[model samples]
Target: MGATKIDRARVADTALRLLNEVGLEGLTLRAIARELDVKAPALYWHFKDKQALLDEMATEMLRRMAAETAGPAPEDWRRGLADAMSALRSHLLRYRDGAKVYSGTHYTDTSYAEPMERHLRMLVDGGFTPGTAARAWFTAYSYTIGYVIEEQAMGPDPSALPSGAEAAANPPADPAPYDLGARATRLAGHPLAVAAGEELFTRHDPGFRAGLAAVVEGIAATLHPDGAKRGESGP
Candidate 1:
């Protein structure tokens, strides 16, 4: 058989698939090449290095997210902000180490510009100044990204253990589950911590929503107080 015709998209797609199988630490050019039925050097022709490939992968991930999360921007800035962020968090949680893969990587194309502009415009239309809108978006973005990083860290591999070099590169990041009884025992000295553990560790969905609501409210109260009232034109 002949070598598979490789392109940047092909490489990124393969890397993303391997990401769940091996994870970010274990994802390498050589492995991707093996999957592609090509030598590692052939991959370098498209992606100069692993980081370059990662950048492409991140871009593709964002592109997929944009495609999957299609809707009219909510007129209410708070709901709009929360909805946008919720979608982002959902997308980032799709792959193993997904948040890490997306965190620092730059988009390889202008595809991100449209979605960002649409969101910023949603805030601006809701009465925020352009600068404040950008800041508001960044605040939510930072919160969601940081939250997912910690979430992924808590249970890096939700399935099987890492094997071979994957194991060496990334020892299991799994932490002990802080159940109520365990929390009471392990954190007996700190009653508050023990009490908080249930909400903090065991209840991720509600906790995230509650925190996001706080973030939305804080932004309205602080950054653009009038924006919420103006934005309340829609659900």
Candidate 2:
């Protein structure tokens, strides 16, 4: 395609694919231009620099996330917030180093406004003051983004162990030589330590969900200081 035909969407799409192949550090405007079979300068027509391209990429990802998560507004604003966050996490995990890429860039596009308004409205309807609603949305968003970044950093799950033959051919090295069993035994009298140890070393999904639940609960508590509670909304 000609340089004039190469729009920001096309550039962002190519950049996202390159991200999965080369990761965030390796992704560059030149790399995207190469992928498009064009000179590096051609990409500059759509994006001023790598940062501009990254911002567009982040905006595109969030655009898709907003679309996928959009529907009839939920009656329970907490549920709406939770579902929106879950969708955001799912979208970020769709690409390699996605959370890092997303966290590094800002969404400057007008497309971001709709979802932002929707989320803010949900929180406001949930009894939060306008300022508190904005804070609540960002607080949850920051938590999800930070959690996913750490989860991605840890690499894939060990429980998805390699085949027996593969394991025998290339046995994984034990970075932490301390026997978890023995450590658990030593801490048997301290239930809290044992639980904390287990949570620290295991797959992060359950813990992530638990933490997300706590965050939602905290938001709910803030919205409803009295013993009375809001009615649950249907999916």
Candidate 3:
């Protein structure tokens, strides 16, 4: 039998696995090539460089997400949008430093054409104006990407807080890492937030959700003049 010609996706999958074990810093073209049992030059023939390969991997992961979540209904746009963001967050968090691969990268690539078409069509059918639809899509994209970037960089959720009594009972005399969370808790001052202090810092998804909802709602408001009047739609 002749020597096997490896698929480009096989290379990418192996690279992602290496990312989980050794992380972004240790990832390299040569390493992936080695893992795939191909020559480094062969890998370069498929992807021009490190960033190019990473961008391809990110795009591929997103394509997988779109395949799983690309369904539409005018009445269901809000949940559809939320589900898309949630899926994207989960995929990026699946590998070590996955967000690093996606941050500041292009997802508007031709390989993403199908999902792009689906997303835009859903927005249009949801009664969004052209500008409003574009803004909503971009806003959700930015918020999700940014949240994941910070999520990986910070190595934990930023929203976590301590119990109120626990916070008050053992106030640190000196500056402490937990001090920031405590201070945020005091500053937030919402009744529900105070009651859920320990649960607050668990994840960044809620903040991201709130932000996307606001953007989607704002866009919907402008697109459907009666949206603020009716309150049953989103971009």
Candidate 4:
């Protein structure tokens, strides 16, 4: 293929596919080139290095998220924030190690601008000052990223736990290690700690939504004490 034929989008697409196959650690310029039926040098023409390619892949992921979630902004600021966050979580969960891939990469591409502007506008119109709106966005974004990272680390079945009988029969060789059961016992006397431990060890979706709701409520309290009653006019 000609140099002009290899674009950043193509490279990003290949990298995303490779992400599912070999995961983030195995995704490399050489591997992408091999999948593309091109030499490693050919990929360099598009991306300067692996980080550059990874950035584009992250950008592509966001672009897809924007496309998938595109719609009329919800009139309710809380609803708008919830919808955006839900969309973000869904997209991040689509690929293996996707949260790790997207956590810190900056998208230099302009395609992220429209969705970003829309999200900010949603908050700003909902009675948040421009500064507060930006902060709210970042706060919610951080929560979503962190939640997904932990969720991914726990694997697909968040409820998978050793039974009490199983644990008693086969105790760990090293008792001092971080054990969920032990940790739960330590927090048993504290209601809040027990609730948090339940949320952490059990299903993550409800907990994620609950946490997002709390974040939104806190932001609303800070920016609009009246809960932005009239802030749902437009976006």
Candidate 5:
């Protein structure tokens, strides 16, 4: 492929596909160029550096996420917030190290702006101040991204074990099963740590939902104390 034939979309698409094969650390510009069958210099025409390509990849991920998450906006702000965060988590999990690709990267397009505006407006309509609404979104976004990053690092399993590329990169010093009893025995020196291991390591799906609910509830109580009364006035 020549420089003229290669566009940002193709480069980003190729990068996303390579993510599953190489993981983020192994995903280099030269590697992407190899997949594209072009010289590494050819990619520079579309993206100046690896971060530039990552930003485009993240932007493309969000674009597909938005396209797939179609529905009537929930009338309740809490539901809207939770739904948005859940959707983001599911989207990030679709690719390997997806949250890593997305985190701290600049967007290549304004496509995210409109949906963000709507979410913030949803919070504001539910009686949160504009600043509070923005903060709430950031809080939830940060939590979801951080959670998925850790989750992916441990692979798709609920155990402390790493799988796939993660395992290949950093094998565990002492590999263990997904057994809570064994995990507790290993952490016996720290009683609290032992006690928490079960909840921390297993049942990730329920744990994530519970934590997200707490975050949403905390935002309501702390940022919008009069939210109930004010929300009653909303359509």
Candidate 6:
């Protein structure tokens, strides 16, 4: 027989399931304990409070994300970095509100270090300065989080423009007043975006990949100083 487990990992897994089912707003120690068929105080033996549980879940998710992107590649640091962000975007979409879980969270934890270190080293090998590499990481990382949040906010639907057809059919007739900020750059002179603009308004992998590529390319332009010559060239 397999040895019985003692650590709180199982409780964390169960709670994450609850999070997926109900969402962050509904996750609680008492609810998770009920899901696991254990009393609430039993959970206390493992986690001190809700924040502790959220931390554990966040760590687990990051570990999985890191594992998905680690590997050898001869192409260049940019492809590797892009692949890493793609994996993150894909995995987060698997769960409701996953982007929110990862945004601005602590990444200095030793567990999250290996993947980050690898990416930074790869960037350096590709001729990026340390400060540039760090900044690129930040830019790409924030883009992933921000993009995924917008992806989640857009429910799955035809109106969520994956092809520009929707936007063409439903262009806001007038320059409408958007709330304080707009998620997409007002689609005005962008062609690939115009030709395939629907992706911008939808929850999709292609759109996510395109946006991440744009952020990474933006970082490349910042680092190399000449990459900017081709600004707004489809990332």
Model 1 clashing residue pairs (backbone): none
- By lDDT, is 3 or 5 better? 5
What's the true lDDT of residue 58 in model 5?
94
Residues 1-235 of candidate 3: C-alpha lDDT, one tens digit per residue: 6665877688777887778766788899988877877788998778889988888788777777777776653456777667777788877877777778877666536867777767777777776766767777888778788777766664532123233697578642321224446656686867675555434344456656777688667656655546755665444
- Tens-digit lDDT string for candidate 4 (92-156): 87776789999888895898889888888988888788888898889999999998888776554
lDDT of each prediction vs. the true structure?
0.85, 0.77, 0.70, 0.79, 0.84, 0.69
All models, RMSD in angstroms: 7.1, 7.4, 9.1, 8.7, 6.7, 9.2
For residue 189, give model 5's deviation from the true position in Å. Answer: 3.4
Off by over 4 Å in 6: 1-6, 73-75, 107-109, 156-199, 225-235
Against the true structure, whose TM-score is highest?
1
lDDT string for model 1 (163-204, tens) is: 679978996543445457965897789989888776767556
Clashing pairs in 6: 161-198, 162-198, 162-199
Tell me model 4's lDDT, rounded to 2 decimals: 0.79
lDDT of 2 at 99: 91
Stretches of candidate 4 off by over 4 Å are 1-5, 157-197, 225-235
Per lDDT, the best of the predicted structures is 1
Which parts of model 1 are misplaced by more than 4 Å? 156-183, 225-235
Superposed Cα deviation of residue 193, candidate 4 (Å) = 7.2
Per-residue lDDT tens digits of candidate 6, residues 1-235? Answer: 5533435788878866676677777888899878876678878887788877777778888877767765764358788788778778777866667787666555425788787788888887887778888888878888888887876665431222233686568743321233212323565566565544444553366667677777777777766444644564545
- lDDT accuracy of residue 62 in candidate 1: 94
| Separate clash counts for every candidate | 0, 0, 2, 0, 0, 3
Tell me the deviation in Å of residue 174 in model 3: 26
Please give the range of 10 consecutive residues that has the lowest summed lDDT in model 1.
171-180
Q: Distance from true position, residue 34, model 5, in Å? A: 1.2
lDDT of 2 by residue, 72-157 (tens): 66878878888888888878876877898898687876988888888788777768878878878888999999988876665542
Q: Model 5: per-residue lDDT, tens digit, 115-152?
A: 88888888888878899899999999999999888777
